[model samples]
Target: MLLKEVRDTLGTEVFSKEVERAIEKKVRLHFGGQEVYVKQSRPDPDERALAIRAEYNMTNRRELMERYGLGRSAFYKIIKGG
Candidate 1:
């Protein structure tokens, strides 16, 4: 999937759960060849820096712009580690 699609999907609460499911499925399929379902919970960052990184990871710059109503320059500033 494209980053844009992933970002849009992540906007929903179900996205987290779906990600968990995908991870569990892959682990089971490749490692043990077992069928198992896992519940995916939202990541809770312990530090502000970690949280900001996580937020960035969750969406691309374009998606972030649409979500936060920001411009490219601001997004670039943020992701630039400045």
Candidate 2:
């Protein structure tokens, strides 16, 4: 998938410059069966959610929900501190 697609799919939650670079590096290493070489640790869910909220800048809510695999109620719960 294109970088834009990946970014959209990740919905700014877990999407960071470092994460993007890691993904690109992994993809490039895939042909050599060395994809695991670039493996990096992932942030926990709460941290990811916080990052998403911080990074969010008027992106459509519907699109964000869809991309992040969140239900309407779940998304609202996160935003509303419930």
Candidate 3:
């Protein structure tokens, strides 16, 4: 399906079935077995930083640590400037 769509978009005059198959093979070969990490949740670094900074106080340090699942060192680093 994808190959047919690509061939349609590129035009069969330039990319025939054989050419499309070869390109697909090369692409799979190049990208196959690669460890891919896709972020599951919304990752807003700036917003998170602001929230952390606003919420980082002396009293609720443990709460912040627990909410973010960070160790003391990592939480401190993140608040400081991660």
lDDT of each candidate versus the true structure? 0.60, 0.73, 0.83
Best by lDDT: 3
Candidate 2: tens digits of C-alpha lDDT, residues 5-59: 8888887777877788888888787755544455677678797577557655666
Residue 60 alpha-carbon offset, candidate 2, angstroms: 1.3
RMSD of each: 14.6, 11.6, 9.3
Please rank every candidate by TM-score, starting with the best. 3, 2, 1
Task: For model 2, name the residue pairs that clash.
Answer: none
Tens digits of per-residue lDDT for model 3 on 1-82?
7788888898999889889889889968987888757678965867876888899887888998888776899878777786
TM values, all candidates: 0.31, 0.40, 0.45
Off by over 4 Å in 1: 1-52
The model with the greater lDDT, 2 or 3, is 3
lDDT of 1 by residue, 1-82 (tens): 4434764766756456567667667766786855657687644423433444467864565766776565778666656665
Pairs that collide in candidate 1 are none
lDDT of 3 at 20: 88
